[model samples]
Target: MALPEPGADRRTLDADRATAVPTMRSAAPLLKTSTAGALLAIAVMVAATVGAAIWLSIIDQRRQAQEQLTRQAHAAALQIRARLIETEQLLLLEGSGYAASADRFRRDMEELLDANPALLRVELRGRDGQSLVGVDAAAPRPTVAAATRTALSPEAAAAFDSAARMNRLTYSRPYYVTFGATGFDLMELVVPTGAVDGPMIVAVYAPQRILDHFLPSDQ
Candidate 1:
């Protein structure tokens, strides 16, 4: 106990060195495993980030596609409205001596029907709701404006009266037409004849034809 043997001390140092060597060897495997686990976590994060980006891109593309379709549809709608306004103006002009004679009026109506296939009938009616000039696209033109006398439905009467009273063009509500092409709706436009008591020009339109002419074919 007073003085340790030099050889004993050397053996003790050797034993301690052997123990430390195994501890370092064991620690190396743990370090390698920790590094590998860290790399795997990083790889998973990268994959998840990429997937999310792809999903977002797809969503953005769909949104842009929908917006483009909506814009196209809106443009088509504007064109349809412009066409309707033009037709109304034409009717009003025709009533203002564009066709002075009854024969001339009937001829003009026939021409209009021929030009626009969407029109089913065109009539010039007095303020009292009497048809002054009536022409059908499917049939021959009437002999004279006063040749035929027929009672109008309630809706037509109201529209014609309103147009005369308001001194402006009036639109009749949509109605189902049984005469031409089964199962279709028609809308009538009544335009004032300039004078307050003058006859009105009524034009019957086919909605499906109007859409087909104005809207995109693919849509």
Candidate 2:
């Protein structure tokens, strides 16, 4: 009354409304919470990135390990090959120094085969594919293909004849020999020995396991 103090109630109503509607100043805590949430999301993203990096690193390490193992296998194969070549050279040197004729050579070959059962085959072949000396002294010489005899081929007959002509110590780059059948490329070495005037052939065969033994288990 007093005429309702002319707008006093209105002022009171306005004050109540102001109290009901939150002020901008009171929202600082909410802003802080929003900022914390954004920071948490960034942390999650960073953690995922780090995890991916770690996973990639482990994969790279495994790849490197596999490559190293492969290199070792190849190196072992090469070493076995070299030792085989050396063995062939030694056998030829010993044979040429002691054996003068086909008979002496045959005897030497038999003794060699007897002493080392691992020696699959040790033979002396003429360029014409004739067996001059061999482990089975009674085995007949088989005809070699003209294509093989003169050139480098996996066919044993031709390779043997081809190896016979090389003047220096030559290795026939590994071949296989089967009974009553042509040989395949394995790990055989053919060495040419004899006087410098006319070289003789010395073909040596051994188990392919010699190389396989050096290979790693994974290989």
- For each candidate, what is the lDDT? 0.75, 0.59
Q: Which one wins on TM-score?
A: 1
TM-score of each: 0.70, 0.55
Per-residue lDDT of candidate 1, residues 71-150 (tens digit):
87789899888777777777877677733567877888888788776677788777777777778875432121223227
User: Candidate 1: where is the Cα deviation over 4 Å?
Assistant: 1-14, 17-40, 110-118, 128-151, 178-181, 195-197, 216-219
TM-score of 2: 0.55
Checking candidate 2 for backbone clashes, the offending pairs are: 148-158, 149-158, 174-188, 176-184
Which tens-of-lDDT digit does each residue in 1-219 have in candidate 2?
Answer: 346788899999999889866765588789999999999999999999999999999999889989998998889879766765666666667646534576766677776555433354556655455555555422233223333334334545445555565555554555544435555333345556665534355444445445445667663
